[model samples]
Target: MYAWAARWRNAQRPKDQRLRDAERSGRPPDQRDQITQKLTALMSTTPTAHGYRHPNWTTPLLVAHLAREHQLEVSARTVRRALHGLGYRWKRPRFVLSRRDPNLRQAKGSSRGD
Candidate 1:
């Protein structure tokens, strides 16, 4: 009943509907904050749930998994959200190719000279 009433009131208003906007982008300030918090928590812990130890994924890996496997519109931004929500504390290198930067790259190259 309250939801219907609120919707009716919003419908009467001519300007952008606050309630509708809230529903889409998360609104009511408080509710959005709460949901963001929840989503953040979920994102942080989702990896562990899926047996993944890392908090973030490489661009290609993320695209293939989130977009293709999970079928979610989980762009980098969304991934950030999940990380933020989860309060993730770990980070793994992405594209840290040994050839790209000698100083950073530490791939399994040939054994160092004795």
Candidate 2:
């Protein structure tokens, strides 16, 4: 309860530092489309030094990675927006559960269940 109260108090305080930091940057941000295009071309043909490690930096992978890695600058939501503009949709394999198998997610449990 103490920790929760402390977190709640912190959340109530306005984000002054973040606003100041943004003002300090003093420039408009780069366009994601341009960045995506550049990153896509570079990854598709060019052999980057880091390419050995980041081999699967394709268009989708690039978006996904940026969405994960540079989360502050590039979020998964923004990546989804970009992908949608490029006529792409996020799809992951869904498990085909047996009819008898119960869904654990729908089960009632405490927050500590995971």
Candidate 3:
């Protein structure tokens, strides 16, 4: 249809006369790169190392940290999307109690009736 006709018309034009891709219209590209680099650098280390009281990173915490440390304002959802694009995955930390107490099982059993 229209596309075929347009392609046929384009084929007839000289190589240099052909239409080029439209320039992207939006925020400048460098801003995105700067944000991405800052995010990646932040992710490479623990929050505590950066003077954040938290032991690990959360989406909201990351947003606040970015604004505070890097002066980059972004939303938690944006942070999550950036993290996803960078191939990072979130997993919960596992906690296991050590078997240092011999009476641990007995104490738990005794408490069950209450």
RMSD score of candidate 1 (Å): 13.3
Model 1, residue 91: C-alpha shift (Å): 3.3
RMSD of each: 13.3, 23.1, 7.6
2-109: candidate 3 lDDT, tens digit per residue: 865575578777666555544788775545677789888988999999888988889998888889878888888788888898998988977878778775455555
- TM-score order of candidates, top first: 3, 2, 1
Query: What would you estimate as the lDDT of candidate 1?
Result: 0.53
What are the Cα lDDT values of the candidates?
0.53, 0.53, 0.80
In candidate 2 the C-alpha lDDT for residue 79 amounts to: 57
Candidate 2 similarity to native, TM-score:
0.31
TM-score on alpha carbons, each prediction:
0.30, 0.31, 0.58
Q: Give model 3 RMSD, 1 decimal.
A: 7.6
The 10-residue segment of model 1 with minimum total lDDT is: 27-36
Pairing residues by index, what is the TM-score of model 1?
0.30
Which parts of model 1 have CA positions greater than 4 angstroms off? 1-56, 90-114
CA displacement after TM-score superposition, residue 58 of candidate 3 (Å): 0.8
